[model samples]
Target: MSPPEHRIIAGIYHLSKDLGRHFSLTDINLQVTNGEFVFLVGPSGAGKSTLLRMMYMDDRPDSGQIVVGSFVSTRVTRRTIPGLRRKIGIVFQDFRLIEDRTVFENIALAMKVTGTPMSKIKQRATKILTHVGLYHKRHDFPKALSGGEQQRVAIARAVANRPAILLADEPTGNLDAVSTRNVLELLFKINAGGTAVLVATHDIEMVQSFGQRIIYLENGRIARDHEKIFVGDVRDRMDESRVSRRAEQLSEYDIRDEENE
Candidate 1:
């Protein structure tokens, strides 16, 4: 049997992106290992989308090395990029499914591009559609579905090839409360199946519930990286909700230290 692959699927070393005066990512370094579930959290415009884009090869970093599987983002040639992408899957907040295609066709096409056989494509499409609770609408066009349904199709298509790493940007941003829970649960199910999942989200309750490793960003830098601990929801009006409470606590500590000095 072939030996097990490296635990680290991707490694980012001193990665940075600058668009003239706008710096999206600054000296960001991290790693996504095998079967790990990580949340990329931050306030608006914290460069969360930019980071995921760089990971999936939508854009290259202005400076730094991103090693995904075997290809290095800084050095991956255009010709080799397509191959590099075959090992990674990506989903966006906006459902990018083809409006003209049926739900089954949307997912089937993703696998077809990878040269999956017609018979296997049919089987995989049915299985994934059922998994996402969309098999009943397999024949429906994306235009006929709601936002949540469309997003579900996008996710099914993204994972059609069973990639090693799944990058999701606000997967539940367009979903309703129930749909949000459904999608989040589906992501957890996928992660349980051994696909390393990295999600960038704002739903504090979901993060608090899972209590997974959270990578919080601020001003294009990883402000904090740690697990979340929910000490009961306060339902308060304070700006420092559960997500920012850690930062708030750190600020309090600093104040106490200054007073002691």
Candidate 2:
């Protein structure tokens, strides 16, 4: 028998969204697979944010079906939304870190709410901060960091739980040229770690240059899906299975310690 296809992490079928009688998204169909990095490109009001919100189930569609991990939008309830969110991570254009909390505390909040034990949470948080090149500022508050630094914190927090998919909406919007490059590089590193990444941005030049999959949204629909299609790891031809770099595997020392214990 063939292995199960858990690679397809998300799917949208004939989806539509409305904003107070204004239809924001119309008949959108899309899929994101494991270990793949995709770009969602569109101008403002192109429904990029709206589509991301629905994928994470912050809002349900008015006309179609959506699925992330195991929770189907048509079947999931408010009570189940938390569980669904646990399997996915999201970063917004605005650095939504807690203003009152230190950087460490802000990242810790996500793991804490999901019932992560203190020991592992600390280990994972430290490792992820380093991964995003912000370990030196862990003691600082969000306001103390520059805009680029703040976004790095947000990205770190999102992946702290090692979600199966990471959705970032305009993560570079508030950044300058250097900062934008830095943030995008970090995101690619995250993708290399094996978490499927979907970036929603209006940067046509960047998206085109990346040479990865690009799903262009216009008005409220997907006008184009530009990609080089492949089944799985083209490197290891024997096993075409999808691969992922989970959040827990960020630090070899921590993983080894846990195993030794």
Q: Which has the greatest TM-score?
A: 2
Instruction: Estimate, for each residue in 1-261, the C-alpha lDDT of model 2 and write its tens digit.
Output: 986455789999999887555647889999999978999999987889889999999988998999898999999998999999988989988989999999999999999999999999999998999898889999999999999899999999999889999999999887765567667778878887889999999878655655679999987889999984644433332122111121223245456878999
lDDT, residue 254, model 2: 54
Instruction: List all candidate RMSDs to the true structure.
Output: 10.0, 11.6
TM-score of every candidate relative to the true structure: 0.83, 0.84
Runs with alpha carbons beyond 4 Å of true place in candidate 2: 1-6, 20-23, 229-261
lDDT of 1 by residue, 1-261 (tens): 996574899788999887455757889999988877889998767778888888878788989989999989978888988887788888888878888899999999899888999999999999999999999999999999988788888888888899988999999887655456556667778887889889998654557545577898888898888853533222331233343454455568768889999
Q: lDDT (CA) for every model shown?
A: 0.81, 0.84
Q: For candidate 2, what is the lDDT?
A: 0.84
* Highest lDDT model number: 2
- C-alpha RMSD of candidate 2: 11.6
Give the clashing residue pairs of candidate 2, or none. 193-245, 194-245
Q: For candidate 1, what is the total of clashing residue pairs? A: 0
